[model samples]
Target chain A: MTDLTRLTIAEAREKLRAREISSSELTGAFLDAIETANPHLNAYVKVTPEKAREMAKASDERLAKGEGGELEGIPLGIKDLFATEGVHTQACSHILDRFEPRYESTVTANLWADGAVMLGKLNMDEFAMGSSNETSYYGQVVNPWKKEGSNQALVPGGSSGGSAAAVAARLCMGATATDTGGSIRQPAAFTGTVGIKPTYGRCSRWGTVAFASSLDQAGPIAHTVRDSAILLKSMASVDPKDTTSVDRPVPNYEDAIGRSVKGLKIGIPSEYRVEGMPAAIDELWQRGIEWLKDAGAEIVELSLPHTKYALPAYYIVAPAEASSNLARYDGVRYGLRESGKDIIDMYENTRAAGFGDEVKRRVLIGTYVLSAGYYDAYYLKAQKVRTLIKRDFDIAWADGVDAILTPTTPDAAFAPGEITDPVTMYLNDVFTVTVNMAGLPGISVPAGLSESGLPLGLQLIGKPFEEETLFQLGQVIEDAAGRFQPQEWWAS
Target chain B: MSVDIDTVKRVARLARIKVSDQEAERMTGELNGILQFVEQLGEVDISGVEPMTSVVEQTMKKRQDKVTDGNKAGDIVANAPVSEDNFFVVPKVVE
Candidate 1:
């Protein structure tokens, strides 16, 4: 059996209901994991032990009275980007060093109501900008899985690195993570855990700190697909607080788990097999395809010809929106403020002091793209490419492809500081960003480990709101995916 | 593929971040390198293309135009480097 620390939410819940352990005991074991793992991994910026215990105590009361919700006293780490009433959500930047939120986000509020306790805020790249978590002011998150024969520090992907690290280290059963462009999935891929970014309009963004407001959607990072399903159901709601939130009814996510993939159509976009990808990863992708074929699914060769342009289009569109959304943080507004000589200077000084280097870099890039001389040249050109990229996926789905398969990142996690050139760093997200740009649902399931034993994930991208297909096919691949879950931290 | 240092200084000032001359000199080179790399987007011609202003299809996420302050007065002011009551404090306007 897996250690209590690394048990999935389903496993833990079953154990709790059968009186194998109390809620407090379950919470304690995970909390112990957090204490042991956090120092080494730097996954959490804050660990709320007392608050976790209090929630666990409440769960015990609910159980004793024969009342139970989906996630009773399950502990998960929250990315600091989510606003929790009274929790200091710094976004891992010095600008909000003393910032505290007054109200919880719709997602965080829903998790609290579902009886999920937070293990406190996890670290992230400042304002969720970088592909790697190294840009976080707090520090970089080391990948929990080490190279089999080497003792080097590796990166757990980001800007959701903390969530992935904590999950891989068995610090939390699951974590709340957001993906603007592969923030959740890439990190999960790096750390050998499962992370899902649901359909774009599925989750409310009212209280979550905005990145690219349009692309940011929060979901769960867990050990199994079912745990992700249950957490997804509990968190999905038509939140009227966020105007961008859709009024769609939540689906019975877990009800569909264990459903068979008798005749599903999976797409392998011809373009995704990039020129320089590793042979091991190429073989792993092929293996996942073979598993689906054995399960009676049809493998179709689809073309998203414009897939090559996804990264460039995304960089333009995301930063363009982010430039505008982030304007709210100017000194006089809600975020941190810096005093200056006059009103104008105040805006200048405050923002100057508040934002970190990467945030500023993005702001500048965004501003330049939106600038008069360049607007028509850069921003407009990128948008046109976006339309073509969407058409590529639209054509594939039209060609009877139920879902598309690709590697989450080109390869497994890299060692720290290996890729310093920002453009090279940006290229790491090549396969994952396309899904976000097209506003589709995509998931990273652990395919297998690399030759040196680092994790590799097979990304399955489905049509928008077609997450059900992804989950069904995932079950088949997961059965054959031996040793996909994290090896025990102690065993190392 | 070189960016003028003066242009970097101007962009930095526009961004409202205070960068030293030495930093600006270094950043000018870095920014030039980044721009040169990002300039690859210009390789594809996109005549008559409209800009994608928002990723989410929504034009704006609006709430009711109610006549009430955001209401979390204390919490809003807590992060202020300087605050008084429910408002952020700044230098007095002499005008």
Candidate 2:
């Protein structure tokens, strides 16, 4: 009741380690908060307090032995997209609403091994196809921050809306997030929290329900840049279970935080300074540049000439892969089986009834783009543009730019349902999608607030496996921000 | 750009979704809007642009052409809705 809400994982860990609190005590605070706030926020799809309490008791016992993994005693809100053994991981769709897996995803298992308590699964866009959480079958997520005297509900950003809203509201300290194209960063930006999409293959995806097999990467969303870095470090492990997961050694991300950014070069791509971008975003970006300059870092103007093509290319590639990846859900092996007299009827009936409108749209687009007659026109063309987008970044990075900084979303989070057409909504990821396509690392740090009191986010994209630089730049940008996105949801 | 509602119906069939006639008509308009939006990219001449897959400039690792999945017949059929004598039960394809 004393607003134990906004405390970071480190703060909670320190409190517990000092015997000032127990893991049960910390978990109780969040459990209480979830009960009090979840109906209003829809941040959590499920809450396993008994399971959480058991984990907390074990963590407290572990602390009694002076042994702690990096994330010990931490209560994490997992995106429902990850499979949890015996827990319903529906990917926020009715099709999988009853589909509880018998196996846990590598990421969730690793976090559990690191001693993190499961606060239960958070909501996500249905199959993570939409940029805004509104597409979720469970319902839309409201932004934790509301303008004074206005009853207009705002978006918490999507497809990780529930994760962002929960973390922003302090219902959980950190939530696991996945990004194929800005699912993590866009929601983080909308909620005024920190979210990172690590280099592709940084985290194992064996149990994750796939959206785009070629592009999906999972990371963490939390209250601070350092906390995001810590959570990311624990979640990433090279797993033999995931064929696409690279066997790269995980780096010491915690050590990289608070490092000086003196003499670091930040690239400012003029192309990203899009026309009609909100003025508040511009001011926040300029402030970020000034922060770097004040820290003895140099700013350079660069051009990613193929920037305009990224959004189109991503639409083609993401949907194409999503179509194929989702082909597994055809009422056969597992999940929401529909009984029909004939085999073909069973597959069609289950899928047609199971999937929502947005999911169906992606499946159609995906099939169309990959079809024999049109594959060369759409999918192949997009692949070519994808190459140019990558080359554009290669040229800039090769030009001696250490990292590129841009507004994570071209605009701050919008009022829920303001976007009617889906493509306009998909365009929201114009800035963040390129990084996922390039298999590079990008982090969204809160820059400041807009005049309307919504959070503005500055995205820092680093070269492949250059997460340390992202953390470094993120810290500098955080200092310049000076204002936390209004997270009033916790106090209430 | 003449639009065709029949193509939308065909797409829904291929996607295995039973879209109502009304929904198909609506989808035709929406799909056209998306195609128009994406058509903006065609303005930029990618005349000789090379298609690239994997965003990372590095090459993907190739797996040996060995069979790692052939022996899992029992496991593959474990979740089958209908199975008979270790074989997945599908409706007879031809008479």
Candidate 3:
């Protein structure tokens, strides 16, 4: 039999429906793969073997009864950010040590309802704060893809690093990931996988650990474009629990996979061609435009004048919101708590010991921005620039642009500790934060190999609630570039 | 506009996260580096642009006000570090 672990969600679905493979067998294959690859990759923080078997058994019964959910019997890794009932739901932060929620996050609940089996909780940056997975308290998640012949350990871009690496290494068919300032797209770009950050509120935030409430969104990372589409259809829904979740129906995203992109106006933002962008990334971006053009997408040159200010504004607004949201972890309720002389001292000590450096830095920055004296200059000013950034895209859309295309990251994956300065790390989100700023949807499609044979991706940003368009365009790029997989370095 | 150790200390106090003199010193330089980078926002002419509180424009979603949830204090306190009578226990603040 073909390797069960190698099947895409769509391919697995067909085989299971045809009775060529049982859910138990498929789930077991993935469990075996995880047992072998997880130690080296550090992708999974907690593996739920018993829960997976139980879920797969249920799925087999459903399949036997000729009734199964869209993702019946498929195994997927859950990013530790989501609260899984009675399961580990720490956001890879010391603050959430050993915490497990009784209630399931709405996104994970939706997946389980579709009969997807839980593989494990994937690792991520503490509080989903950093660009590289190095901020994870569980230690950095190593990217499965290494540079050409060097055995140097590269970072899986984060805070969705584990999800990206797991899917890349075929430890899971697909994985749930979140994005706040490019967590999903940047990591997906780094690991040769497909990741989409649906429009804000496309999926419920009821159970996912809050990062920056306004910018945080849940989506999927998958090995194939169609797999991402399939996973997203099951993951997205309107929930009464999350008032921000839109009341629109979740469309069958798989239908968009082969949809025609002919005559589609794909805007290429001139501002994205920033100074000092790596030559290989530039060449990949040019190749992306040619691929789209060949597939009949009309590439139009455009300018987002406020693009340069996006990173600056994002740092302010995200931190401000993060400081507010993270205040709930005061050592009174769930998670870690350190002893102190009194209540005030306890709060301080608990937080000081609990949060990692990046999380602390962000929380402090958040508090600083929202402070009485600096609120107007930093927080309020950044909010105003956020408006201008969103308006830039609105203006382009008014000019009949169906979707905007750009390089996913400034460069491909970098080795751990390669970029130490926070400012340099912040630049990883330069090409992606604008999509979040505008509440638009974006997807990263692995498009080309770098000079060192590492994968690079191109992003397609779509209008609000128009993920279908991104999937269509992403498939075009995917079909053109073909799929990329790192050789079995971890397993070996 | 630069973040000095004093600024880091003050911000840490406000955020309720304790930091020592050494961490604060290191943080001062790091925070200043970020502040210097974000200060570029000053270059943009955002005159008269309304501050966007949220990208998705929506009003407060209203539903018929009634008891919709609750009655699960056990579940709520299940993950608490310390609990008593299904209530989260915290360090005593009262005299």
DockQ for each of the predicted structures, in order? 0.46, 0.48, 0.85
Q: How well is candidate 3 docked (DockQ)?
A: 0.85
Alpha-carbon RMSD, each predicted model: 2.4, 2.5, 1.0
lDDT at A179, model 3 = 97
Range of the 10 consecutive residues with the lowest summed lDDT in candidate 3 chain A: A1-10
> Would you list the clashing residue pairs of candidate 1?
none
| Candidate 3 lDDT, A1-492, residue by residue in tens | 228898999999999999899999999999999999998999999999999999999999999999999999999999999999999989998988889888999999999999999999999999899989999999999999998879899999999999999999999999999999999999999999999999998999999999999999999999999999999999999899998998889999999989999999999999999899999999999999999999998999999999989999999999999999999999988999998999889999999999999999999999999998899999999999999999999999999999999999999999998999999999999999998888899999999999999999999999988999999999999999999999997666
When 1 and 3 are scored with TM-score, the better candidate is 3
Cα lDDT tens digits for candidate 2, A427-483: 899899889878889999998887877788999999888898999888878877753
Best by lDDT, which number? 3
Per-residue lDDT tens digits for candidate 1, residues A1-492, read: 226775779988887777677788878888777776677788999889988899989988887777878788788889989998888787787667667777788998998888887778998988888877998988998777888867788889899999888887888888989999899999988988888898787899888888887678888888888888888888878887777677668888777677877777888888889898999899999999898888888898877877777787777677777778777777664566676778778877777777876677677667767776888666778778777677678888887788888888898898888987776788888898888877788888888988888889888898877777777777776777954654455444
TM-score of the second chain of model 2 compared to its true counterpart: 0.74
The docking quality of candidate 2, as DockQ, is 0.48
Docking class of 1: acceptable
| Candidate 2 error regions (>4 Å) | A1-3, A483-492, B1-3, B57-95
The per-residue C-alpha lDDT of model 2 at residue A364 equals 81
Interface RMSD of each: 3.0, 2.3, 1.0
